[model samples]
Target: MISLVILSFTVKKNYTSASTNSFTKTINTIVIDAGHGFRCENGCRHGSTGENITEDQVSYEVSKRIVAELKKKYPSVKIIESRPTPFFVENRARAEFANKNKGDLFVSIHCNFVPKIRDVRREGTRTETKYVYVGKGKKRKKVKKTITVPVYKTYYLPNPAHGTETYVFAAHKTDDKEEIIMENGDIFENEKDDSTINNNINDPLIKQQVALWTKQFFANSVKLASMMEEEFTTLGRFSRGVKQRQKGIWVLQATAMPSILIELGFLSNSEEEAYLLSEPGQQQMAESIVKAISRYKELVEKGAPQPPVNNGKR
Candidate 1:
């Protein structure tokens, strides 16, 4: 199992920094990020707006349920939330908060956009060019060809695009994830053992290992993502499968934790939108997330000694 492979802790003797195989300490705390808030400008919603229940509202609702279920199941596990209200939190700030609180995992929840008549927007680009003189003396002369770049707009109209999908930072961008994790060591707090505190930080190999650990995060992210999609499909939700999204997915990369951004469903689709706003739908979403997390936690903790961890924190 991927969980068994990842749960195996790679404890380097006499080393400092985070434990690459530190599931016992790492999975003790969880963080939930409810994506984008409802903000109106000129009587129009600015982001993820549809079906009367905005994306943020649905995410928030689903997140609250996830928190409740996690607590109900784990009891002693610590849970940290990025937002406690219907407010907007910048992606970087959300990641920062998760790290500051020493969250072991970060789950960002969002509803996919269902393009609509109102959701449609126009955007396009054009180009222009000029020619210079051949010789130095001739170059000094003002010689250019005139051109008029035409303007165009693509109407992003409403479509019946709906599904439950999960995302991780583009795995190919491993260097970025490594740098982010290294700069913010709090994510690796599990490595701050008294024994390894004095371990040399100058070792080139240790740095390499730290970078390799980031790759593991990508792997784990993908693993958990697949689990969520599978869970959703089992529940009769249309699963779009997992995908790597680099653009517009900052929290996944910026957070120094195993992170995943989930698109619960598309608001454009009536049936999906109804489910998203319904209590049962929200609860199911939360259940899927909790199940995935529990499976992951169990797999990683297998065979590994359950060292007592005082995870009694907010």
Candidate 2:
């Protein structure tokens, strides 16, 4: 299992200087990644599974809906899919595809899961016979004893941890993010020429530029994640809020552009699983995401100042 970690970092002078520049960035291209799919080597790679539904299936369904809705509402904006079908796509390959297409934002959809709660109860008592030594030394003799033993039956219940949350890459993992940005500098709309930075990654100026871009991406990711959680909350869903893991999520950090992975809800919860599998529930989730993306685009184009990054509201 992949565990998540959270940490905090302060924004640097470079990012502050860059943020004051003219608002030239626009969210022209968005990449939507369905969490998992079928992998031949490992068979099916469903992220999490419920009694009758799987995370891969739910993610694909929600992603497809989001694609359709975005196309309908923002016809001029280009939308790309990381996994168009229920087939495996390597994590690195997915990030490369997003960068290659010059995606402005990347949204990876997934389901949350927790182990079922185990409950044990004494169902009844059973009679048992055992041989025991009766008294002391010579007087002691083998005796048959009848005893009653309590029998316990264990059962599983769905985990109660059901809610929606979003994830951004950890701040301490900036090196990985910086390397990706250095490799694909052109993806940063406000940054210098791709070749210039890529060719002079070791140069002090280029290194500073990459670091600024990395921080900007992190800030944007946190902003977008917060907006998504807000949307989920507005839709009457519990919001676990934005989160970051100390260990980097490959899809989130590997992409050059701002990226986030959304945990729609806990599939291990029976009620949430039914909700995720239902048509209304899926449509509502897609709508919430689409709404958030629309707002994020507007804010970015308007040059809205990014909110300060913190430990996040868990």
In order, the Cα lDDT scores of the candidates are 0.73, 0.80
Evaluated at residue 111, the lDDT of candidate 2 is 96
Which regions in candidate 1 have their CA more than 4 angstroms from the true location?
A: 1-26, 39-46, 116-158, 186-202, 305-314
Clashing pairs in 1: 9-21, 115-158
Output the lDDT of residue 100, model 1: 76
Model 2, span 1-314: residue lDDT tens: 00000001111223334342433256778999999887778686657888788899999999999999999998988898999998878898999998888788999999999997899999999999999988898998999999999999999876789899999999888899988877764443333222243355576755665677688788888989999999999999999989997777998888877899999999888888999999999999999999999888888778533433443531
The TM-score between candidate 1 and the true structure equals 0.74
Residues 1-314 of candidate 1: C-alpha lDDT, one tens digit per residue: 11211222232432355555643334777898888864544344435867577888899999999999999999878887897677776677898898777666889998888556544333454567777564576456656865657665546566878889999888667777777766654333454342242252335655666675677777778888889899899899889999987563778887777899899999888788899999999998899899999998787656665443445520
For candidate 1, give the lDDT: 0.73
Clash pairs (backbone) in predicted model 2? 5-245, 5-246
What's the alpha carbon RMSD for model 1?
9.9
Query: Cα RMSD (Å) per model?
Result: 9.9, 8.6
TM-score of 2: 0.81
How far is 106's C-alpha from truth in model 2 (Å)?
A: 0.5
Best model number under lDDT? 2
